[model samples]
Every structure is written in C-alpha cells, then in structure tokens.
Target: MPVTDYQGSTSSPFSFGRSLLSLRRDTTAIMPSGEEADLEAFQRHVASTLAELLPAADAGAGDEFLSAAWIRRLLEAFVLCQEEFRVVVAQARRRAGAQLPVAAERMVAEFHERAVKALDVCNAARDGVDQVRRWERLADIAASALGAPGEVHEGQLRRARKALTDLSTLLVDDAAAASGAGGVASFLSSHRNRSFGRARASPSRTAVAGAAASASASHFRSLSWSVSRTWSAARQLQAIGAGLAAPRAHEAGLAAPVYSMGCVLHLTAWALVAAVPCPDRGNALQAHHLPAAPPRAAFPWAPPLLALQERLAEEGKRKDRRHSCGLLKEIHSLEKSTQKLAEAIDAAPIPLFGDRENDVREAAAELAAVCESMRDGLEPLERLVREVFHRIVRSRVDGLDSSMHNAD
Candidate 1:
C-alpha cells in the first residue's frame, strides 16, 4: 500500500512518506515531480531494508540475531539509506537552486553535525571489535590447551586455567567500569602492555623521564586510536540525539527526509554501541537516549525496526547479561563456553574420567567454534565501520563543496 493510507495516525511522521505528494496537490511546491518520486522511493527502500533484517518469531536457533552477521547487514542497510538520502538531498538542492528554504538548510546542517558524532561512534566500535578479537585470542589459547590429544593432563589444564583467569579479569574489569565503579582508564590499561621502545642513552636522566612521560601521556590520551580517554559512547549518543525532533511543518518537504535520516543515523549508532564493547557501553542503551520507537501505524518500517530494538534491549536486560561487556551473540556464546569449560576444569577429579574428560573437550571445541566465527566476521565488520566513517566524511565534504560552488 502507498504510505498515504496510514496518514490517519499522528500528523507529522505519517506525513513523512507522503508529504511531497501532499505539498504538490495542496499548493504550489518547489520539489520537481521526479524528485517527489525519488523521496517516495527512499522511504520504501528504508522500509524494505529494515523489514528484511527482521527474522520471524519462530526463526531457528541458527538464525543470526544480534550476531556479527546481523550487525554487518545492519551496517549495509545504513549505507544504503545514506546513499539514497544523499541522492535526495542533491536532487532537492539542484531543483531548488538558490531559493532553498532556511529551515531545510538548518535541518541538513543538523544532520551533518549528528553524522560527525556518529564517526566517533564508528571509531569506538572499531576499537571494540579489536577488543573482542583480543578476547578471541585468549579463548583460543584456552581452547588449544584443553583440546590437545591424549588423556587430559594437569599441565595442559594449568595453561587453560591461566588463560581463562586473565580473560575473566578483563571481563570483570569491563563490567565494573561500565557500571561506574571504575572508568575507561582501568579497562584500557589492561590491554596496553608495552611502553615506549627502549629510550636511547640520554645525557640527563630527567630528560629521559620527561620524554617517557610525554610518550605515555600521548598514548593514553589516544586510548582507542581515534577517540579520547574521556569519550563515553553514552555521552556521544546523547550529543547526537540532543535537540532532535520531527521536522517543523513548513520544513517537511526536504526536511522530512533529513529528519528520517537523522533518526536512522542515531538508531544505527546506538545499536553499534550496544553490540560492541565501548567505553560506558552499558549505559549507552539507556532508553531515554534511544530514538523513541516511531508509531507502528505511522511508518511501514517502524514495526521491524522496533522489533529489533526491543529484541536487543531485552537481551541487554537479561539477568545474566546486565553486566555483559557486549550484547553480541558471539560474545554471549564465548562467555557461556568459557564459563562451562572453566567449571568443568574446576570440578574434574585428578587424571580425569570418561564424561568429565569429554566435557572439557566438548567445551573446548565449542569455544573454538565461537572464536572461529569471530575470526571470520570481525575484520569484515570493522571494515564496514570504517566504510561508514569515511562515507559520512565524504558526504559532508561533498555537501559543503556543493554549497560553496552554488554560492560562487
């Protein structure tokens, strides 16, 4: 059905999909009929993209919900929406020429600012992916130690226990930091092992100490490479959502798509912060900071998007997950396998028995599989995040350069 049929809901968002047609029919309008077609197409694409991401309620256990593959698909959808919006914005500008409304300009400008904040989110998420990789390595160590052939040996168990211990420490620290008991510094310090390479023999000890301190300071300040030590995913999301609202009445023509894009941007970024381990990752899912679920009746895409949001939120709230470093499905699988393997190691009698030895090996095999999946998925996921970051940059630059050319 054409989205206009849903116009009986709230006036603003429902008006979003059909606003161009309303403007064309009710009054003289600036958007060309062809541009109106493009806007409608954009909304429909958004709807279909999100609809495809929603798995059925009875989806099999193998379905990839909140998994790395699912997140990749989400990023793909974001890229598609971004590409379509870029076209719509460019077409609107070309048609309007020098007479573009001030409100439309402001809406686009606001979206640009939000897009900048999302870049920081992408950077943090990349680091988070790196963090998960670190965990995967530790799990691989444990898995290898336990999965060795022959009877389960004490020496092998010792190595596996040590790896699990270190993994536990990191996980616990992250949980504590996310809850505000500690902050990102402690969490990052756990991962940073090396110092500045050996200082050359210096004439003065004081100079050497100063240089070392400077290097350490610079390194710590740039904790996640691109984000600062103080950068909180929670605060960054809040910054992106601040002052965001539906487009004002007069601005609904071009402004409506701008508003829709802003909402998608916020939702996508928020979902990344939830799935990946970021500084203050736990608090990033706070409901108030989330884009309020658009009315289901108001937009065709609302139901599926909201379904996914609700599913993620429910996962976050799961009793075992409240303190989880991340809500990604593989992370959950990793944690479960590690815990079970740890328990098996702790409970086993000396020289190991049939079921007990089998348990250890089984658990090891499961953990290894989880690590393998992460190995295959994370690099691609990080690449997608980087793509998102650069795409936003290119769009902003193109928009600014276009405006300058028009002024000239």
Candidate 2:
C-alpha cells in the first residue's frame, strides 16, 4: 500500500506467502542465501537487488551495498506480485466447467477478475511501472487456462484477462452502431459478452450493431445544455466516450431543441425499443437475451414508476412496463432496437402521427410488416438517437454540477 525505500524503521522481516495481496504487501527483506543481516541491512540489500533485476540502472548507490539491498527488496516485491497474479488467474481459468467445489470455484473466479483489475490499476498507476511483455506473459498464462479440455474452461481465465485488456483500449469506437450510446457504467454493466474478442467492423451483424451502439455524442450538444435538478445532483459520473458522447455537429435530425423532461422520456423510449420483441432477420431481432438493467434496487426508474402508478389514480390501461429502465439494451429477453420504433406506433404526442388515433393503427400495421422483413435494419438509426439523448442528459447534469460546485 505504501511505497517506501529500504531505510530506517520501515524495514520488516522477510517472509513469503501465496496470496496475491499478501505477496504484494510483503515488506520483509532477506539477504541472498550466502548471508543474512539485520532488518535495515536486509532491506538495503533488497533495494539493491530490485534495481538490478528491474531494467533500471543501479543508480544512487552511494556505497553500492545499500543500493543492492534496496533493488533486491523491490525485485522481491515485484516477483511476489507476479506470482500471486499467476495463481489467481490460473484458478479463474479452472472455473470454466466441471463441478468443482463451490468454494474453490468462487475463490478462483474472484481472484481471476480482481487480479486482472488490480494489474490494470497498477499498470496505469505510474509510468515505467512494468514492461508490456510482462503483461503479455500473464496474458498467455491466462489463455492457457482455456486449454483445460472442455468448452467451459477452455480458457476462461484468458478470456477474463483479455476482456480486461480490451477495456483498457482507447475510449470508444465511433464508427460503431450503438457507438455513441453508452458510458463506462453502461459498457461494464451491459456489453461484456459482446466486447472483448467479438468486435466487428460494420453494422451488418449483431456484433457490429452492438459495438456501434456506443458511438458519438454529437447529438446531445445540440440540445439545450444547462441546469440540473435537485434530485439528480449527487450522482458522480464519469465522462462518456464517443459511443456515449453522441453529439451533433450543429446539424442533425430533431436536434433535441428543447430541454424539458423530454430527454428522459426519449431515453425511456429508447429503452422500450431495446426491450420489446421485434421481428428478426438471422435472429438478430428475435434472439432473446437477458435484460440490461440497473439491477434490483439500483433500478433507476423505481421512483418514476412508483410515481407513474400514483398518477394513474384509477386503474390504467395494460401492463406495458418500460423494460429498459435507463437504456434500451435492458429490454425483456425479447426486444430489438427496430421493434421499439415499430412499437412506438403507440408512442404519444397526438399530432405527430397524423390523425393521431388513425395513425396508431396504420403505424402499427406498417411496423409489423416492416419489422417482419427488416428486423434490426433500423437499429443503427435508433442507436444514434439514443446517443444524442444520452449526451443531452449528461450535459444537463454536468452544467448543473458545474454551477453548483462553483457557486461558492
């Protein structure tokens, strides 16, 4: 936890352990097998060894002896971390298949995930932290876990690590379909399966459509950006990338001109599109999957849905729930982006669809036929719209926060 030089009262006895965390935290210093020394002297020798083992030149070695001690100490810590990570990653791989003991499986899985994550945090913590080759070797080790014979384990550890590596890649893929529609939270929570090794180059397949889902935020900037609501004031959020940043270049369709609660409604609508059942081509529209959710209580719409219930006063129409609580991807295991648009046949705003009542029936019929053939053909368009809305929502929040924080 604390970085220190091998000096003074900080030196502790050297000991070795198998746990990744414990190994990383090891502070004891032991001289080479040829000799042993007191804590300070041992620590000095460790520091010296670490410098030599690491690529750095043995610099600042005033008397040379203390330097070897310091470098060695550092190297010991590094080696410990590497070993710990290897074990954990191996365990995670072991979880691919077969009914291993519950405890072992859980322990292994967690170690794999966290080891990968910790490596990332550490790798980025400082410049010259470690060589890229070191990570590559870890990657190979993780991948080998996949060779465990069955489809399950084949390399789950390798898979997890690779996923983590992909996560470290550049922010967003603008040329993607859902390209500008999600954020860090959205990606981590919703797109895990589609991310890592499955990336595609165009919007022709599900993979392409999925990746495109997070592109550009240009649409949001076109919307009136400012002010924040008291209710949404405390949530700390990260900056959205291209896919979630969906901005417009001063020119785009329906450019989110108004700043009413319209953006929320629009986002909600997008969620509906993502949730409902749509027609399928190559099963893109029909292949049912789980919901992209805010989780149980983390459900963002609980408050609004509760209010919707109260506002209904008496019993309302059907039991149509907005399956996509915060975004479209969280729809029922049966929805597609295009289906939402078709489903929007019932979307409100009386005048927008012509004779209002008549248009619903017409649009419904047309949507059915269109979905029957095109399926997700319209998904890219929907993703773009969602991107715009995401930006709009984010900007409004940011503008408000900026003012609030700067108020005093």
Candidate 3:
C-alpha cells in the first residue's frame, strides 16, 4: 500500500520495516520542488515534509527509535549549513557599497535571527539524548521481561542506568560552574601551583607549574575549537560592520559590538566549565594541604565577567530544569506502561495444549504490545526532532539562496 494509505489506516503494532520505508520516502520528498520559489511555499513544503516523517503506529519498528547519533549528525549538518549562510551574507554585505539595499538587508537580518533560533533548537535536540536513552531502557526492560535472555538485558540496563546517573551529575556540576560557585577550589589550587612554580628553584617543582599552565592552555584551546564556527561567524559579521558606511551600519544594529561580545562571553563560560575539575577530582585534591595563594589584584574586567558568569549559570539551570521536566514526563509514561504490561502478562491465558509453544506465542505478543506502548509515548519527542531538523535546514537554505540571488 502507498505510504499515505498506511497513515490513514487504523493503528496497529509497530513494525521496523514499514517505519524504515516511510522514512526513506519522506526524506526523498524533502527536496525542494521546482515550483516552490516563494518563501512561504518553501516553508510549507518543509513543514509538510517533517510531518510526513512522524512515526506511524502501524509501521513496525517495535525495537527501535531514532538514535542520538542520528540527531547529532543532523545537528552537525545544520551547523555547517549555517556557517555557509553566514559566509554568503558577509560577502553580500561587503559588496553593498555606501548604501545598503533595504530589502536585502532586511532579508539577511531575518536570516541571521532565524539562524540564531535554529542553533537553540539544535542544542535542545542534542540535550534530548537523555529522553531517548530513557525510552531505550524501558524497551529493553519490556523485552527482557517478555522472555528475552536475562544476562545480556540486565547488563545493558545496568550500563544505561549508570550513564544516566553520570549525566545527571555532569549537568549539575556544569550548572554550578557556569554560575561561578563551583570552580573556586580548582581555580585557587591552580593559582597556588602557579605561585609555587615561581617560588621553587627545583626543576621538578618548576615542571609541575609548567604542566599546570600547559593543561590550562590546552583546555582553553579545546573550548575555543568546539565553538570555532560561531566565533568565526561573529568575526565575519564584525568585519561586515567595519566595512559598511557608519550611519548605515549603526542603523542596522551591526555597529554595536553586542553580538561579538555575546559570542565571546559564551566561549568564556564554556572554557570555565571545561577547566573546572570534576567533583571526584576536586574532592581528592582538596584533601592535600597546601599554602593558600595570595589574592591576585582585581582586574578591571572582573565585574562584567562576574555578571556574565551569573547569567550563564542561570541559563544552564534553566536548561537543566527543562530536561528534568521532560525526563519526569517520560518516567511517568514508562510507569503507566509498565503497570499495564505486568497486568497483561498476569492475565494472559495459560496453555491448554503445548506448554512451551503457548508460552512463546504469548510472550511474543506481550512484547509487541509493550513495544507499541513505548513507541506511542515517543511520538512527541520524534516530532520535536523532525521539526528542529526541518527549521534548521530550511532557514540555512533560504538564507543561502537569498544571498545568491541578491549578489546576482
């Protein structure tokens, strides 16, 4: 049957084959149609394509859901496309002479706004990995309960539970560090090490200081590299502003250094988070006695840095809270489904005929039902992933196309 027919049919058990086939068809349909030149039409096309990709109830994929790896790849693609769009916009702005074209400028500015929003969407989707992992655990539990081998399934569940615990700890630490409250011990310890290096004449002591500096430098480099695309884009925008006529640039909000400053602050907070020692390491280090380093002279930039740190911490808290709420919802759904599964298994009819054959058949049916329940719970999350992918791709493509047209 055609894919559309499957969509309208009564709900049925999940099937991996049908889900895969539908996804293939929907992805193919996302390509731009020749007639969709208008912006609204293009957006409609993208939205429809995304909607089409939603998981189907009758589509059999009982054991599978979208993977975090797949979402990461999609986000990477989105970021690369945004980078390309930024390049095109910068080039166009540079070529615009004394007076920028109002329409072109507006279009480009809108594109910039959308690109920023797209990044937020992508980040949220990336964080949704916890939700995906939770669903996977539930499915594994259901399978194991329905006669899957105990040893392998138990091991998988144990590992998954451990990962979730680690993730929660990391998020809490990250939120604290971002807020400036969590990293003081590590910072002070590193500072003391630096001071000791200056005081000690021994080669071994000096080497320790050098190693600390090297480690700090490496951490900074890694953090910068992680968001290098955003930094590069910000610089390009700054360059465009520099080249524009002063009045025009100021009117465009490009003259203000806010965008660049925001990017730098973001990078700084990320670096701090990276530099802070994990709780375990910090606890271990604090056990050793060392002389306190003399307080360093206050920097002129200290106030602003403190404020930025506070803001970043707040943002991190908000994100963590959001994820927690989502996780709670998932847990609630899993609980309900699990209760139902237990009831179904208890109520399942005993074999009047062949014992082994009846047990296998009943177990398989119960497993399928459990899988269906899990898939139903995941529909909202799957839709969210699809929508984010669509928005990012659509915005970047539209921006690139607009820039190219204006250049012509």
The lDDT of model 2 is: 0.27
When 1 and 3 are scored with lDDT, the better candidate is 1
Q: What TM-score does each of the candidates earn?
A: 0.79, 0.17, 0.29
Error of 3 at 136 (Å): 2.6
Candidate 3 or 2, higher lDDT: 3
Q: After superposition, how far is residue 143 of candidate 1 from its true place, in Å?
A: 0.5
Q: Against the unseen true structure, what C-alpha lDDT does each candidate score?
A: 0.70, 0.27, 0.34
In terms of TM-score, which candidate is stronger, 2 or 3?
3
Residue-level lDDT tens digits of model 3 in 241-301: 2322212322432321223222322322132222222112122112111112112122122
Better-scoring candidate (TM-score), 1 or 3: 1
**Model 1 / residue 116 / CA error / Å:** 0.6
TM-score-based ranking, best first?
1, 3, 2
Off by over 4 Å in 3: 1-100, 145-336, 342-408
True lDDT of residue 55, candidate 2: 30
